[model samples]
Target: MYVGIDHSTTGIKVAAIGDDGELTTAFRIDRRNVETAGAFLEVLDDRIGLSRVSLATVTYAFGNAIDEIEGIEDVPNRGTTDLVGLDYGTGAGATVFDRLYDSAVPTVVLPGVHRGLDTLHAFFRHYSALAGADKVASMRYALERFRAEFDASGAFIWVCASSSCMAGLVCGGRLTGFFHWVGPVHGWPDPEAVRRGVESDFEDVFMRCGLLPRRGADLTDVHDIADRDLLQSVYWSTLMNVYALYPFARDLGADGLDAVVLSGRLMRRERPFPLGRRVYEACVDLAPVRFAEPYTSAQGAALVARDVAAGADEVLGIPVGDVPGGRDR
Candidate 1:
């Protein structure tokens, strides 16, 4: 079996995939509940049968320190350049990374999309970072989803709308650009938010500047917000973010998007309003839009582990590294 670990904003998610590429087990652990790596491993063993894992692919925060998929031991600073504003709860991600490094399971870490990556278009180098490693994993799944469902492989955009909104473009089968959450328009921050971040603290600004938070909505219970007006605002904001990516996609030489894959916690919610369907309808005119499962990132990571163990050299344009004992699989 192959395993994938996603250290997300609210929790640590693990997904195990059998040799046939079928999902066998999946679970999420609250960051607050797992203070130590031992605690995390114990929970993982209980839920996914750790002893049976052949290879485990893990994603931590930022992932800007490296540009290739590398073994856990080969990465520096746990695959990050800095930890600013990443101390979610109990620093569980750090604990999980450290423990996985010393564990018996062969593990590899993924890099985030950033200026340092040579695969991206030169225009995207204006920003320092685009998305995290989990986003790359998500893009991997989106690529497969696009090919499997839409039967096209030209180009596509993956839009993730959750606590924050961001989009990535895959053109010519390579990750070429991204619409990051830090941008001024339709992203997490507006001019007002930038001013507020300057006044108070910019560390946590990204988490506090989304459309929901800007409208004074509670993020902890985002799915529970009953205000139709607020939901409409969020729906339109997400649509606008998607709309903003079309020109960029075309500029990168994509005739047009083969499809647009939508994923994230918000895209899966149905309460108060059918936000996911609304967003999909808004974009159906542009291209085929598909909803991805919530476990997409982890599942994609599992696929990565499987392919790397099978001696594949690259995944979705991201180069693979020599994973010490991985080829033995």
Candidate 2:
């Protein structure tokens, strides 16, 4: 058995997979969670019998200076360096790396693609950095379940989650360039702006512009778009895509791409404000288009972990690190 751990925006999730490709109850903890290694091992001992586990894979922010996972230190916070860099000082996922390492089990830490390391694939590195290691886990899981229905081969995906919208490419049997649109501090703007416009004292000006939030809890109604808030997502998304595309394209390659995929909470909203449609419309004029499954990162990370334990070369076209000590050098 092997364990794949996803360090997500919301929690630290670990999944145990059997040799036959079965997934047991995946365990998770809040980003702020801190526990002694012994206590954590006890929990794993009771739930899935960690003693039988042969390998563990985890993705989280060790630090901006963390070129390889070996230099990662156990800071007293969550992966807040990015957030704190942006002035959102909660330090949520920092302790995760320490706690997991304390288990003293054989483990592999995935590198966040960064130009600092002089990585050949820095573009994908940044996006995965934003999504963290967990999203990779989720995407792998989602791909395994939906592979028959979608053509994920030689494709790039754009995902929108709670705080940001991210885009990535899978090619050559490895995760390529991934870019984070939202900065360390501000995050994604359209959602927060829409929420603020909903509750602002400037309702008169907003109403004059026919802007408002979803009425009475029903987001699918025409009123949703008629209101200024949702209507504005169209403009905001357009601006975001325009700015995001350049960096994204640079990561993919100068020759261009085969297809584009869009997925995220905002994209899944009842009111389709033409963000994906616009991106597709814009990109389709230049290339082909594809849609990705929601919640793919979490699923993908888990599947990647399973494959890593089996010594596989690629998971859904995303190249993974070899064994626990394979990349240690």
Candidate 3:
């Protein structure tokens, strides 16, 4: 079995896949619920039986410390240069990484799209980092789905709007660039919020910059929100983000996107409105649009483990390092 771990903003997601490329099981553990590495490992064992895991691929915050996929034990500081400006989630992901590092699972750590990544366009170097490793994994999964469903591949854009909103461009199956939003609805803070952060502190500002909390909505259940105005704001904000990146995708010389893939928690909601369908309808003029499964990142990471164990030297243009026990087939 191949295992993948996604250390995301809300929780840590684990997914398992068999050698036949079929997902066997998947689950998520909230960041706050993690007490210790050992405790989390015990839970994981109970859920997926770690002893049977052939190899595991893990993603952590930022992923800027390295540029290529590497073994867990070889990565430093859990694959991040610094956590000063990052929103570390109760140290749950860090604990998970430490545990996997010490274990004999032969784990592989994936890198986030940052200025250091050579596959990215030159213009995107303005920011130190673009998206997390989970976003890359999500895009990888989207590309696979696109190829399988459409029987064609060229260029595509991935928009993930849930706790926050982010979009990336993938041309010829490689990540080219990303649109970074600094607004209340995005994970990053806006200029006004940055000024406020400087005035007091950034930690408080970063935590509250997300859309739901900024609009005083409950984060526990987005579908249960009673405020129609807030829902509209979220829908428009997500669409605008996609629209903002459409021109770039067309002008990147890929002759327009083959499709626009949408994912994230908000994409899965269907209460007040079908968020994913609405977004897809709005974007149909730009290109065909589709939705990715909720566990895309974790499942994509599982695919990475499967391919790397099969001797794949690269995934989505990101070079792979020596796998601890990977075969050279």
Candidate 4:
């Protein structure tokens, strides 16, 4: 059996893939009450036997270290990137990862895709950063969905928005580039800023920009706002963040992408929510749009675990290495 774990900002997601290569058990552990690795494992053990997990792959916040698939012990900082604004569940992550490491299961950790890490290049790139392997995992599933549903051969774009918005390009099975500058923290870029081609440090922008908080919000106030101006403005900001990557998905005068993967919180398991529905409506005119849930990262991690246990060298084009070749973005 293989195991995939996603230490997302909101929860700890775990899945167990049986020998048949199908996900047999999956569930999300709410981070609200999860304090220790033992508690985390206790919940997971109830769903999928850790003893049955021959090969396990885990993804923690940021995932900036060790670009390729590598053992958890091999990575420093628990696969994080600078640890800036990543205090969501650091202790929980350490506990889960530490327990996983001590387990008999041979576990590997994956790096989030970032600009400095290895990936295909294009005319467009993130200002200085891209995203984590979570986006890449969604793209991997998007590719499968396109092949299975569209029956077409071409590249696609993944527009992921939630606490933040990010875009990734996949062409010919290679991750070409990504856009993280306009993520939620990026808020909506001013028209003059666009005209000026204004640029700034991603961390600074992330701290100050974006239309909404990446995490918790007092939806009560959001629900009580009159005139609806605040909602509309933030809505536009989110749209802008998504559209910023449309051009990067294709070359000039191109027909556009084969499909659009509405990812992150806006979409899930081929399901599209309100924001995701709008993105689909807005982009369907250009090409088919499918909602590929962001949680596929865990599934992708399972795939990684499966393949690695089977002796494969890569997972959906991401290299496997004990150490990454470049610094984390």
Candidate 5:
């Protein structure tokens, strides 16, 4: 069995996969459960049975520093030297990475596709510096494994719609470029708040930026776009993410795009908000759009680990490092 770990803004997500990325078991350990490696282990408990994980794929932080997928121990600064660059719950992610690094199981770390490494294109300049690695893992996992799961193939534009909306492309099986847009949901500093010295740190402000927290208890449970103004904003933000990335996708080769994949908490499995559906409807002009399972980064990362363990040099066309004998170099 192989495991994939996604240390994201909220918590540490883990996925155990059988052959060909078939998800066997999955759970999310709260951020509070991962303050330290020992604490993390206690949180994991028997839920994961880490000892059984023959190969583990872990993703952390901007993923900017590391170009290729690498071994956990081999990653630089947990895969990025620029620590203070972006704060998307990175401290928690790093702690989780350290936990995997010290473990007996072989851990493969995936890189965050960015201007720093993937391609120095004008479109992928500064904004992608600290785009979460989980999104990259999701993109690769979606494309590389989409064929098996859906019997679909070819290039596609993937939008990770969450507190933040990030859209990118996989052209010819390669992640070419992307656009990052953070909605008011991820929080932006209110000039008045900053003026009153409310909070200086953007991350702190950004954490409170989501629409759910901004709303009261009554509307908290409301998921419909019609009643909730928050969902309207969210719907607009998500749509813009697709609109922004459509150009990049088209530039890469619109003709090759097989589909547009949306993955995130907003794309609820049970019922998609009408506004969100409308937003995607607009995006259909570019290509047929669909929502993949949420938190696919973990599954994708597991797939990478599985493929690498089988002596594959790449996962979903993303070249991974050669960890000889599954030992850290």
Candidate 6:
């Protein structure tokens, strides 16, 4: 069995793949309540026998084997980029990694993209996972959807939803070297900020963003304002952040590509909430836009696992198990 874990900003997700490569069991847990390594094993034990499992892969908590994005470097590391190996007791990945190590199970860690310039050239690269955590971004998901419908290939732009939202390019199964930047503290807008443009007051629109504080109130039958103006503000914010990384995309225009896709928790909403819709609509004209729901980084991790287990020469320039680095290049 192959185990894939996504240490996302929201929670820890564990998925087990069957021998035939089908998804077996998947579970999610809050990032905070993890008390010790035993808690992780307990969860795995319930899903499948630990001894039967062979390979386990985790995302976002490990060190960067290839940290730079293909072309951009100004954006600093956020989220797990600063913490490699999950050894820090405070970092969420640390507890998870520690537990996995204690089990004496074979494991592999994923890396994030970083920005750095070539010593000999004026060019820069946004180094990250070969496919950026092996997850589909908005554009990649859209391309899959678009190809299914149109029977054609096209370029795409994607933004992943994790602790920090990262945008990249995807075309012909290859991701972009360029991407935009925004960490939680820097990119996520305050609810009050979303309300500024709407006729509704800040509190009125802030609640509409689907994030609300729990106050132990027996409140039921709430309302979703669906305010047009509030939605537009959120839309603009998403686009601008992505556009901020446009230079990297231009640098990697090796193939003709144009279009956008929306992926992430924001894409999962059934109704095109104001923020989500605006972002989608704004980019629709750029190319035919599409939506891919239930974004799962684990899918990417599983793909990488399959590749590594087969003895890939390189996974984004880092050695995979015993494979020598740069052999794939």
For each candidate, give its TM-score against the true structure: 0.88, 0.58, 0.90, 0.76, 0.80, 0.63
Candidate 2: 10-residue stretch with minimal lDDT:
205-214
Model 1's number of clashes is 0
Alpha-carbon lDDT of model 2 = 0.47
Q: Residues 1-329, candidate 3: write the lDDT tens digits.
A: 99889876568899999998888998998777774434677878899887999999899887989998898988988888876556573488888888888887779999998999888888887888777798888887887777754323468888886766778888777788887563233457778778887887765555566666677755564435555566566678778777877776666677777888998887776767677778888899988888888888999899889888888878888888876757873
Q: Count clashing residue pairs in model 4.
A: 9
- Tell me the spans in candidate 1 whose CA falls farther than 4 Å from its real position: 36-38, 149-153, 182-202, 215-219
Off by over 4 Å in 2: 20-22, 31-43, 62-92, 116-131, 135-153, 183-268, 271-295, 312-329
lDDT for 176 in candidate 5 is 71
RMSD of each: 3.1, 8.7, 2.5, 6.4, 4.3, 9.0
Over 116-198, each residue of candidate 5 has an lDDT whose tens digit, in order, gives 55443466776547366787778866775456433323567787656566777676666677766454345434664355335
lDDT of 4 by residue, 5-24 (tens): 87655567777777676768
Q: Judged by TM-score, which candidate is best?
A: 3
Runs of candidate 5 with Cα error greater than 4 angstroms are 36-38, 42-45, 85-91, 119-122, 126-130, 148-153, 184-227, 254-256, 269-275, 324-329
Q: Write the per-residue lDDT of candidate 2 for residues 1-329, one digit (tens) a residue.
A: 76766544445556776766566567665544433232455556677676776766666642343333331233223432353223213233335455566766666555444443333364444422344555455445544554454443343444443334455545433455555544211233355455665676332222122122223333233312334354344436433543455455445553454445555544444444544555556666544565655435544554555566566654544344434623322
Q: Please, what is the whole-model Cα lDDT of each candidate in the order they appear?
A: 0.77, 0.47, 0.78, 0.61, 0.66, 0.47
- The model with the greater TM-score, 1 or 2, is 1
Candidate 1's residue-wise lDDT over 1-329, tens digit each?
99999877567888888888888987888876776434888888888777898888998877999988899989999888876544342377878888899888789998898888888878888877777898888888777655655333478889887655678888776787877653111244567767987797666666666555566656655545566666666677677767877888778766787888998877776777788899898899999888888788888888888878887777777888888546743
How much lDDT does candidate 1 score? 0.77
What's the candidate order when arranged by decreasing TM-score?
3, 1, 5, 4, 6, 2
Give the winner by lDDT. Answer: 3
